[model samples]
Target: MEQQNWSLATYCVAPHVAGTATLQGARLTDFGGLSVPIHTSSTYKVDSAEQGAVLASRKGWPELRKDGSTAKDEFFYSRWRNPTVAAVAAHLAALERAEGCLLFGTGMAAISTSVLSAVKAGDHIISQSSVYGGTFHLFSHYLRESFAVQVTFVNIEDLNTLERYIRPNTKVIYVESPSNPTLRLVNLEHIASIGKKHNILTIIDSTLATPINQQPLTLGIDVVVHSATKFLSGHSDLTAGAVLSNSQDFLKQVLFLQQTLGSTLSPFDAFLLARGLKTLHLRVSHQNNAALKIAHFLDTHPKVKVVHYPGLSSHKDFHLAQRQMSNGCGGLLSFELLGGREDGRKVIEHLQVINLAVSLGSVESLVEQAATMTHSQLNKEDLSEAGIDESLIRLSVGIENVDDLIEDLRQALEYV
Candidate 1:
């Protein structure tokens, strides 16, 4: 198969148009087609046994200090790297304006590997009180028990708690902007500044606000991670993750740790991720617009208690979100049903257009009760501490027409 003669950056494609540029990479003439042919081969061939040994050795052990890669660092086996996976990473890096990017088999893989690569046993980590349930489990349960690492979760707005808790051994400050379920945003510039002042690495899981809506790296964060299965994939079909960094050193650590952990993203899933990136800008734009309309609708409804969307003027961090993400608030928002848990369930049962399921950034809308669904791992005390109410229903707006979505919600609210 012949590859595309025009590379991602071979022409007039601008950085602002990286989403479109990434799809162009898939149009490989080398494959004798326009779609990115999945390179599903588990292993690649070498010229000779001697060449194979050298290539295997290089692939087995990474040059952790190397910045730019050469053909020598090419894929030897699917475990270490894959051509299709690399293409997705390349596109993601371009999308985030990062020096490099690495893909993982799952979002947890990306988060866990990046954390392990940056910190060591006995080192401490400071993270926001609210984060994805999986992330919370890893930091509070797995990382603590397996590595003897210390973990402190503080409200993102509680700078005093964050500062007071920071210890000499604290090595990383991890945060999730527009945090899961809550949609509560952290001041990225503030947190990044704090990390720089303390000489600590800052890692942000910007899964809720995809690069199309927000780019934390530009706000001075050290590294950016994503659960690409969400908005990055657009459609809800694939599960994957990505790590992007401007620091070559940081990327090297993550890439090495990823291979060591054996959590590489599969080439097949990577191909799906690449196809998703093509319409990322388009999908997110529609999502953003629809989300604003939906949020406004929820706010004015008598059955709703409070709406947590940055687009709403009433949201506490509306200005902060405005400053950081001008494109729009993301496609997600959470609201409190007036009658609490029963009302939440009633609304879910009545919903026709919005799915009563988990996961976001998909073309189909999804609504889930945070306490029982996504954040079920958290105990009552932990949930209360994180300010997650039992009645909270997190809504992920899809590309569906805004009027139909609003109508669906209107009918659903009658049940509440």
Candidate 2:
């Protein structure tokens, strides 16, 4: 019952494996290797013009073939695909429990490309106000100015008001769960149901939650997107983004856009991403627990006005979070300090173990005031509309000891 000659990768990434085995990547040769081998060649070799011709036409995820050679696309160029990049995408696909996934150079690249693919010149997109600032800018500014595509930003909690914003031409509904900086929750089920009823696509930015925390696709979302630079690459050493989907047609379209845009991920970074995946479970689990403890600590502090963490019983969305995220709240939380922006800066500047910085989901905690940093220039009114306040201090809980984290915060808050 011996099979014919097969590529080293196919045999190793066989279905039976899960978790770290999948993260370690497919074997490089007949004899399995423990570490994922990086493929740096920008252009792969081809045996014939016919083979080159076949590879040149490939723009989508290659099929898994068993005849040893049927699935091989080891020709043409890396811009279309690379074994290294493909391996990490496969690993993510397995983790997200999706039919397929794509990797891009940065989170914004993935978001932009997907946005381009999902809408046409005249299509309308409905999005929530509470999202990453970059995403908000993309939908509210660039897409509208260049494509003449209409965009609407609404409060997700007011379903009636949100539904009123939807139009007959609405092609998509984009959501960001555990919203950027604020850590607000959007009910995925409600959005998905609206999308289904209206025959629109539902796209969820689940970066903050990570695959360990929640699975949007399972909740009837058409696609799940992530800024893999965060928790997915726990060390924060690499920058990458991912798109996952169950629809072959949508994936194919997005793949075409991905190639045309040419925001391809380099093989070396792809290798780094693969390495990151190996410890994803370990890192996220520890951080998740740490975040809850930190959130609890923030809750009782007299100087803290409000703490935003779904894991906390005081949170407005605790029941919804309990329903969606089975793991834990996640490694992110936000709190407001007593004295507004000045006091927020005092807390951020006073941190020791927690670095005062923008960007998050690293092994070392980061604290930042979103009003001056992440969220674009906006008045108090605009900030309130997005569920973010001038005094909100966003904290990315790291995997550091909970006691140490609490002690660091204690000294930091004394400044307030």
Candidate 3:
């Protein structure tokens, strides 16, 4: 069978258009189906040992597609690469405006692989204090304790003093925009500029603000990482992660780490991820609208002490968010209760439509107390620094009706 061209379609596709018609990098089959076919084979059969060596080494396979393009980095072992995964990566690369992308078994796998690819045992890292709990643990504990790496958690707003924290050995400045639970945003352009000036790699975990809402690479960040398990997957069905970058060299390092770490995403999971990505724009747009409405409702409620949502004018970083995430402030928000932890507990118990669970970015709404849920590992002092308290309730708005969501929140607040 002659292999057809798997290049992106001829149409000039926009980044946010993830509908079936605009799904990029679909390899056409003889049947001419529009859907991306799942390549489930763990390994490919090569005609000779020479061809196998060529595929394994990824030195540009001799096999040519009908379009006169060689299958550079063709599939040999599933652990190294797979057709299904590569196709979805292409779509993600286009969406993220990155030169390349790599998939991993989980979000942590992606984060760990990307960071490890950049630094060794004694390298230093500067990270924002309000990153996701898992990332915090990876840096503060595993990387620090195991590898003797020096990590300084900084307040990104202190741009004037950030240079003081930098060391000649500093390799990466990591941060999360519209950071988890708090909904606080970092100045992406400034951070990117600082990284460039210092010749340091800048990486952002853009899970909260999906590429539909924000593209960090365009802001000059070196690399963008996502817990594709969140908004990218858009459903609670699959677990996957992605690391995207404009630097092919960085992506190559990530790819090598992914292959060595054996964190490759399976063909079926990659297929599901691709399917979820098809409606990315549609789902996120609805989520953005609903979240803003709910944020407004919570902001004005008497029982709420403070609502952390960049969409709200009262938010500290509203202007920064507007500058970076022009599409929307995303679907996540958090509010502290005036009555403290007891009131927060009552609110969670009374919610009917929203599930009292941990993960976010699903079709269904989820609510959780950050201190006890997502950021539980952070100690009391650490939690305070992250601006998380026992009274804070994080809400992940879904594609549900805004009125119903507001009503549900209203009734829940009434219980408090």
Candidate 4:
């Protein structure tokens, strides 16, 4: 047999450790082409009867055992793994600086799986009150009803409040920094410290601040989750989610839930996510720049009663955001139009370039009335408590030219 020499990029950056059963190197050509051919096959074939016997034996044998043999089984099915999806997962793990990563069908799948795997009946969870409405509903309604789990929503700003809410069964503390629609920045270090003291798992929703802008694992968080559909996909072309964790045990548990729940992301979507990730450094930087400019513009506008952007000094969490996040305060921000809900709707209706949409972090600008769109399920009191007012409009600043985005906002605000 001729000895084949593989490129360094593949072995060095590949998902699994070197010499593992998995592919070790990423062919640069695959990325350069920017199109990873999806492996749509449900099953793989064995070369011969002898090869099948060997594979079965490998599967029956543990990779680590008293025999001291170091080997792994080859791929058998797409459900357990796929080459394309594994490659993308490896790349995402590298970006997240985690030991492993798992892709899911959507952000909610990732969140629900993590919570379900980490906590059990009688176990308690502490989370930020001002979270994405879907997440809030998941914790408050489904998790409670289905799993008999207990959750306490607390103010992220007050560490003491979180401490007060902790119970003997509390096993997970989740926080969403620069929380959805509200733009309230939670102190990652503070929450991580609290989790550590209580021997609790710390999970953060990093969708608002993509890994390009912030890495929660670096701040001592036990796990990081993302609505990859929002920013990692960066084009609104695909729906995906990812969960990253440095702990090998935790990763194994997450993977187990992923398999049992059948919430795995399709190989094609995984490939799209990987393609989007290659340009993340560029796209997110552009968005950050454009967002700051727009936020500043909104701050000075007479019709804008308040702007909830971490980039602005007027924001309550501006300094905290400056301390925690690098680059800039991300491209998503919310502002209250002077006239309230009607004014917010008018501005969104008048925008020519910015689309009125529900999801965020796409390349195209998007504006949404948070109270009526993303946070509509919550009652008026809950909305008020979360600082999500009826007049507040969430802006997902795109990578468009700053002047064009500004002019679009100018025309829209005129309607307000």
Per-model TM-score on C-alpha atoms = 0.93, 0.92, 0.93, 0.88
lDDT of 2 by residue, 201-312 (tens): 9998999998878888889999898998888887878899998898878887888888898988887888788777778777888888999998989999999999999899
Q: What TM-score does prediction 3 earn? A: 0.93
lDDT per model vs. reference: 0.83, 0.81, 0.83, 0.79
lDDT of 1 by residue, 1-416 (tens): 98544543332135457456555544322545756567888888767887788776764444421122324347688887776776567667767767678898889889999999988899999998899999999999988999999999998679544678889999999999889988888888888888999999999999989887788988999999999999999888889998888887888778777777899988788888878888888888899999998999999999999998988989988998889996888899999987998899899889998889899989999999999999999999999878899999999999988899999999999976
Q: Could you tell which candidate, 1 or 4, scores higher by TM-score?
A: 1
Candidate 1 has its poorest 10 consecutive residues by lDDT at: 63-72
Model 4, residue pairs in steric clash:
10-25, 10-26, 11-25
Q: Which ten residues in a row have the lowest lDDT in candidate 3?
A: 61-70
Per-candidate clash tally: 6, 0, 0, 3
Compared with the true structure, the alpha-carbon lDDT of candidate 2 equals 0.81
Tell me how candidate 1 scores on lDDT: 0.83
